[model samples]
Target: MKIFRLTFFLVLISQLALAQTKRNIDHQSLTWIRYYNILPLTEKWALHSEIDNRNFIDPICQNVFVLRVQGRYRANKNIDLGGGFAYFNANTQNPNNNPDYSVPEYRLQQDVTLINDIAKITFHNRFQVEERFIQKANATELLDDYSYAWRFRYRLQATFTLWEKEKQSLKGSISDEVMFNLGKDNTKNTFDQNRIYGALRYAFNPNIHLELGYLKSFQRRASGIDFYDRDIVRFTVYHKINRKTKA
Candidate 1:
């Protein structure tokens, strides 16, 4: 028993050490807020829209803003399909002491989600593909206006009830997502990013749900070959509108 405990602790320490390598690790604190609104047009069709705001807390830098719109179709009880367009505007933080520049990115995305229930816990698996157009720098100007990449992403999530007596109940969840780039424009690294998160959720009378979470994100830098290790506090609000069926 003593040897087993020591081995387990050593393994954890090694994992943390591997995550904080010497290759440009930025230990950053982030605050993220998101709103998701789902409005149902029919029993089989819905409109999904979301907005996200992310900020770095220590130096008070505005990180990114994302706006997403999707059309969702419920194919069956266990499957959902969606196609979406997303716009991203991000602060680049010019290192040359020039004016702070903005990078704009646009994406077309398609996704499918599968859900299952086992032993009172629900599992969600999502697979997505994206075609991204990111603004780059030209030889003469600061912005080149067009660069393309293809990315693939997958996420797995599990949710279970914390406590439930009557109409009010608390739920908890954990999720992990991994992203990979697969385009000729992406040369240095094919591995893009990873996110791991855990959250507590509350449903306020079924029309609105609130989630508060802690997230750890690791990503390679866009313009350069550096990396970032970020710790994030995430808050999200979900509002359901014009619902004809249970979601």
Candidate 2:
């Protein structure tokens, strides 16, 4: 009985220690919502828009908004290629920085899909270039400095239908990405970051879906401060518009 009591006490203490450790690391909570739509302008051409709003409660990033516009060419049933421009606005209201930052970016992406009797797989690849401009200064500088960089990201996902009549499906996905700096002497601001995510998705209907997943991200700074970690749970939702059903 004495040994059992000691073991129980040790377990309780370990749990408390873990909880304290997690509290020490800075935690950021984020909520995001996006709207995507495709408009058919002609026989072979389409216009697309993506608007996203994200809020961060962490010390690093407070609030951010992203917007993008793209033109797509549907070459066939299994492939799509698009080019777009994006703008990002960041609000640095926290005590970490003296000025806020905003950036304008450009991107090109391609998508492909393969469907079979058992399952379906999709791939999306994006290449982006960005120029960052500083804003809301606390100092006496008349103009802000600008920097340019590029990034590449790829995502692969597969889905298997469990009940074809009910549209119930199981899905999994993985993503990999890297960023690089360009057009200057070497600086610590120019580093690379990578991320990988795996998720399971459920389809409520042909037009809407939901996902729950885990993500692992890493950042390698030129100043030798490299950090990597994993996220416990992430949620995602997707919605598509069908013109045939609308009419």
- Say which candidate scores most in lDDT: 1
RMSD of each: 6.1, 11.8
| Candidate 2 residue lDDT tens string, 1-247 | 2432443454456445444542222233454556666666665677778777655434435355777777877676555666666676655323255353443333433433232233354544444444433332334432454444444333333444334456656666665544545434325424344456677777787767777766565444434333323233456566655554221
What TM-score do all the candidates reach, one by one? 0.84, 0.60
lDDT of 1 by residue, 1-247 (tens): 2432443454456446546655666677888999999988888889999999988887777788899999999898899999999999876432222244667899999999997898999888888999999888643345755889999887878999998766667899998877778777776546677789999999875768899999999876654347778899999998888446654
**Residue pairs in steric clash, candidate 1?**
none
lDDT accuracy of residue 216 in candidate 2: 61
Stretches off by above 4 angstroms in model 2 are 1-31, 40-44, 57-61, 93-120, 123-142, 154-170, 185-191, 221-234, 244-247
Task: Let me know the TM-score candidate 2 reaches against the reference structure.
Answer: 0.60
